[model samples]
Target: MTPADMPSVNARAGAAVEALRAASTELKIGVARGTSGETVIDAGGREVGSIAAGVKIAEICMGGLGDVRLIASTATPRWPWTVQVHSAHPVVACLASQYAGWRLAHGEGKGAFFALGSGPARALARKEALFEELGYRDSADTATLVLEAPRPPPAEVVERVARDCGIAPERLNIVFAATQSMAGGVQVVARVLEVALHKAHELKFPLERIVEGMGAAPLPPPHPDFVTAMGRTNDAIIYAGRVHLYVSGAAADARELAERLPSTGSRDYGRPFADVFRHYKGDFYAIDPMLFSPAQVVVTALESGESFHAGQVNLDLLDASFT
Candidate 1:
């Protein structure tokens, strides 16, 4: 038998599955590094292919909301803010880009980094400059705040940015070392927290209470953010194991959207998912109420050729990310 067909490979795969199960509670999202044309997400922190950067960002956005967004255009669309993902590691740029778009839609303000290699210091400067170009003030005290992550800014670099942004070091909330993956992007997670805080305050709620709800004992209820939903959709399309498809923006009119989806495709019975609804959009899928995570929902749809739709509601459920 070939080496791959040996017991060792199966053992390793089994171990990886166990690890994934063990860490599933802590890991809400993960980026799939395509291995041998097969994408397998593991929780043990190893297996399949390189996990790469941006998994933290994906997890945060997905946990916060049911979907994520993509740039969806050749040129940068006019937006309120922009965050550029700098890949200190060259090969992970695509994964990083996927993460960045997903995070941005979740109201964290993110953009994609074109160059990938060493020299994050230089890359960060460019990101800051892009933020300025998007009309955000250089100062942190301004209405808009810029956040970076997964990588720490050196003391000098931090000092320089603080000075330029007119903010003190204490104002900076850098989760330098991630509680999960040591090399994972805590800074990005911190930024997501920062946005959540801003959202909580805007909703006239306590940030601590919101966080508590997210990390409660039995695992918090599904609090889907529209922005996060858009981001998650993008991620679902990209790293999904089977089919990849387009997703609508949270703002799309429901009836109008319904009219657009072409109802055509052979309905397959006995799909492994909760509910396999047929979409006129050429055989779309919807999730059963049982599936909580957007990633899972998307994965199920991709595998089963089903399209996802939120009944005829006003999308009010997507409050967190929409506003």
Candidate 2:
């Protein structure tokens, strides 16, 4: 499909680049101009980023396709910096979450660099099942990506990304952050809503029926260690994250869907995610597929004006996991 015909997560996110640049110094983020003239924002890599930087990183994670804001949490005083996210275009936002997310691995062997590809560019790649299922594609002169790694992506990796997006190498924009950094934690926790949407999709829920999506999760403190950081981030979502989705569907269907939308639905519900990850020997796919959901989910059917709620936040588990 033509660029205009498809949802442009990159275009939406590109609009915010200037604002991020203008506040780079204040946000404690570093902006670098690549040789191809592509703009790269370093949210955590080579910089000690702050919470403001994390918010921007979270937005970038959604391919700038969703709205991310900070708010206070009523769940607990321990986590005050709760992130709130909403997307009118939930399908596009979720697509951005997958395509532009940290799911793709680039390179092999010693030189191989694993990066989470984000941006409107993933629409052009069309490599994953979600893209085909959505029947959506995007075309853009410039592509953007967010890499959850410490260093900038290699030149070859950038070239490969540009080629996949059908754009020149210079027309690429990349954002980098390490998972142990402040920006990394915020961006991952920001996926609370996305996780729910993905779970719904996995369960064969009607994507078109979802009209609005919103989610909230406490922002855990960032750890310099990667494993510790990953654990905390996952715990924030699986144990304490809460989400609400508005759909245009039958009330009964919405209620049934709600019953399956929380992390508790998984067999791996009680333990902290870090322990669970180790239990699976760090094989992400080996873990319970149902565990990758939010702590609570509520679906409101607009047609019937009936809301279905399921799941509950386990603060005690969250405390143990966070500690």
Candidate 3:
């Protein structure tokens, strides 16, 4: 817990990569090296990808600081499973490591390849402004990144990532899944806690005061279409994600945070996320940024032992998205 005990996110993620490699066959995931020598983990894009493999990728996405568990549940009626997540180091694990903030692009038009790079590799790249705000930078001989894409990254992108991280292309690792695959759905839904932490940071809440965090969201079936699958994964959290935080702050601040943290606080909260995306003319940046958050939140002030709850799960919208 001291400055001297600084943990390297990349180091932790590298360990997770080793574990994933050991169990790739059992998990039904593919493991290969990229043309650029970077390691590529095929989790959900191929015919062999499985939900269990996606769970491992989710862990790596948080730099091994978070726990992602699958639970059998009928609480949502439509979903038989739920993804539970928690992190003692929410700020570092979720915001610094898990958030998909790095935009990697190559080529153009039909042959174009674009993906938001998320995971410990981000700490090394320090490409996003959020890293500067966090005042954190990770260094390690090996780096790992998580991508939500339909295919393996191009050699150019892989080399770019390797160069940006100041590591050999052979030392870089990428875990990618198709957004329309079941493994992808599980991994995305597992980001419920990270989404909450990102929204909290966006609201200017004191990140250091957030001591503990946990969240859960129903795991919807993946759709065949990319956009629809994206919608289903997002709706899982926007409609029914439940997040709890133990924060060391004034009760008033906790209450205020709870009031402002839910997806309902956004003007774009009435319908499914896809509908809103279409309303914004398919421009993700054009949509309200505040709309990306849990549907329900309970912020408990650790100082006063009081909890402030805000927003309610919207089953009406959940039903609409799941079917």
Clashes of each: 27, 3, 0
Could you say which candidate leads in lDDT?
A: 3
Q: How would you encode candidate 3's per-residue C-alpha lDDT over 191-272 as one tens digit per residue?
A: 9999999999989998888889999999888889877889999999999999999999799999999999999999888898
- Model 3 residue 21 distance off true place after TM-score fit, in angstroms: 1.4
Error of 1 at 143 (Å): 11
Q: Candidate 2 at residue 121, lDDT?
A: 65
Runs off by more than 4 Å, candidate 2: 1-7, 35-37, 97-111
Report the C-alpha lDDT of model 2 over 1-323, residue by residue, as the tens digit.
22235457777666666688789999999998776666778888898877788788677667666888989977867777799988777677765443344355667898777766655667766657777677676766777777778888777677777787888877777888888888878888888888888888889998878888999999888777787789999999999999999988689889999999999989999998889999988997898989989999899999999999999999898888777
Model 3 vs truth, CA RMSD: 1.3
* Model 1 CA lDDT for position 317: 24
Query: Which scores better on lDDT, 1 or 3?
Result: 3
Return the candidate ranking by lDDT, descending: 3, 2, 1
Q: Which has the better TM-score: candidate 2, or candidate 3?
A: 3
TM-scores for every candidate against the unseen true structure: 0.23, 0.93, 0.97
* Per-residue lDDT over 70-157 for candidate 1, one digit per residue giving the tens place of the 0 to 100 score: 1222111222121222211111111111123211111123432211111111112224232222221111131111122223333554
